[model samples]
Target chain A: MKIFIDPPNSLILFDLVERFGHEPLSVMATIQERVDNLEIDMPPMNVTLTDVKNGLKYAGIEVPSGIRGRLAVWGPLIDQAEAAIIMEDAPYSFGCVGCHRTNLLVDFLVRKRKLPTIEIDYPRTEEDARNMVIRVKEFLEGLK
Target chain B: MVRETRLVVISPLSEITPDQITRKVHSLGYEVTVKETCYGAVLEGPPETVSKVMQELRALDPLGIYSKIRGFPLGDPKRCRAQHGSRPGFSQLQTEWQSLSLVEKGLECALRGDKAEDIDIPERIPVKDLQRFCEEVE
Candidate 1:
């Protein structure tokens, strides 16, 4: 299945659609695009964010205790994602220290549950998203 | 004359000559200024262009390149050290340490393998400690 990983409403979503074939979109983007197209509204978006926020608070993902409160507030939706379009220049993965820390929880889930995975080449600029998606499409094409 | 920063290449007298260095510097669009310094030589231009010229010069002779040179704004040496020392990454702990009241500091110090009573402290208490004390008394 083609995957579009949307981590919170960040640019990685667009990059993912660029990388993987966009036949079926990621759930988060579908929600955002739906909202944009007037099919959904802010009320539903707020509700979804709240639900994801609460779910992550109780998930018991560990970091230093000092950082946990902030993480619990911002981390849930990102952590819950089964897949993602990791940006090449993002502080986390490309060259940042926090990259592995953010991916640690989900990586564990993939190992234990045998989740299908795709690691897209990092996209550096907004314009690169198109090429990134095409690359993803080529990758999926190879699978077929 | 517009003052521009550029990298000046210097080498030991035995290594390279004025003519050879001048040709390389000119090719990189830098005018060699002083060529007879003990270390090597100097060039002048915009800081970025000078940096590129410097890199090229370094590549031309690796053993002769003693330091990575770049330009930055100059400031008061003491104030610069103080301002840099106050950066959040390092000064945050100091702030936390200072913000603690004598009792809290005592408590923290005690937890860290020191006797709370043994630590000498002045009597002024922080409002946070006073509020905590009031709550306990109530």
Candidate 2:
């Protein structure tokens, strides 16, 4: 199963999903593809003009480019996802730290997909941590 | 060459202890610094050495030991939870650490050729129910 994770770049979620025998659809793979292509823009800034055009498919022209740019990357992943894991209230550094608008948009889009999704709060305590894992494990295992 | 840092997490079901893993990592004589963590150990050194050390460590228990590159190097004061009141991504790491045992269990099951069974999960609330709850709150 291809699982889309919110924050798009969370290593924890990525690793866990992969470890549990599912493919994680993360921004890293998308960015890596762009980076690897010499024809595209260079590292640290891999977006091509086509990506900007792709953004229009997800948002209106009036919306900020950053949000659109992010959706261009994330929207497709959500569409491809069979399931999703969304970590709520994570610190800015936990994953994609760019564009709060983009984050919210991504979250709303994933939830709207109505896929087999697990929305978990960022754990602040050891007990919360344990429960978070158990819930994630259960959710992933339950998926066909 | 740029130095690399990695967090190696051992499964709770693993026969090797963190302390034993730490000593084994040290015995490898790599230029790496090993720090035994509650979950496993953190290794900091040249990329090649870190990779080599991690490979050997994983061999100890193929399905029980896992590692990932850490964004920050060990003892990076600005990002260290010990120095700073709290590290930016420490909570995520903590949560991940706690989950390693569950991952180990799943891996073992796969190794034993066991089929995945459906586990009961909480169902999401319907959109209408959520809207009604919000309206009542208001």
Candidate 3:
């Protein structure tokens, strides 16, 4: 199963999902593909015009390009996901904190999909960490 | 040729000391800059050198040591926890650091070829029950 994690770039979530025998749809893998593409000159700065247009599928033309641009990257991943794990109340640095609007839009889309999902809080203590891993493990195992 | 930075975390359950990691890295004589942290050490240098250092570091304790690429370069004041009181992700990193012991245990179990049957996970609440609870709260 492809599991979509809220903070899409979280290594902890990525590692846990993969360790539990599921693929984690993460930002690192997405961005790495774009960066590796030779056709795009100067990489991240040079978002192909076509890529910007692709955002229209998720957002209207009137929406800010930043949100659209983000959607262009994340929208497809969300569509591919069979399940999702959301970590709530994470600090800004926990994952891609580039655009708040994109985060909200992505979250709304994930829930709207109505897939098997589990929302967990960011662990602040050792006990919480233990519980977080256990819940993640159980959730992934259930999917099998 | 892109330079890179990486965070290497040592599991709390491991007997390896941070000093041991620091000394071992320095002994390798790479051009990498190393910052010793509470969890482990941060390395910054050419991607190849960083990768080499990580390979050697992990060899010290394969299951006990873990490494991940960092988004920022070393000592970037905007993201440095020391310069700015607790940079955006430091708390998350700290919290994750606390959980390394559990991860290490899981890795050990995998190495021993054991299943996760030992863990006692409770029965999950059905979606209908959760919806009812939400409706009651509303």
Best by lDDT: 3
Candidate 2, B15-113: lDDT as tens digits: 888998899988988898999998889888887788788779978988778765564557755465676666545565665566566556655554465
List, for all models, the DockQ compared with the true complex: 0.01, 0.11, 0.14
Task: List TM-scores for all candidates, in order.
Answer: 0.27, 0.59, 0.61
Global lDDT of each candidate: 0.37, 0.72, 0.74
- Per-prediction share of native contacts kept: 0.00, 0.06, 0.12
Worst window of 10 by summed lDDT in candidate 3 chain B: B112-121
Considering the true interface contacts (CA pairs under 8 Å between chains A and B), give the fraction that model 1 also has: 0.00
lDDT of 3 by residue, B30-64 (tens): 99889898888988888789878988998899867
Candidate 2 docking class: incorrect
Q: What is the C-alpha interface RMSD of model 3?
A: 5.1
RMSD of each: 22.3, 7.9, 7.2
Tens digit of per-residue lDDT, candidate 2, span A100-135: 788888888888989999998765544455566666
Descending-TM-score candidate ranking: 3, 2, 1
Which stretches in model 2 have alpha-carbon errors above 4 Å?
A: B1-138
Residues A3-95 of candidate 1: C-alpha lDDT, one tens digit per residue: 334222222333224223342223333332323344334332223443444445534534443234323333443444444343333223121
Residue A88 miss distance in model 3 (angstroms): 0.8
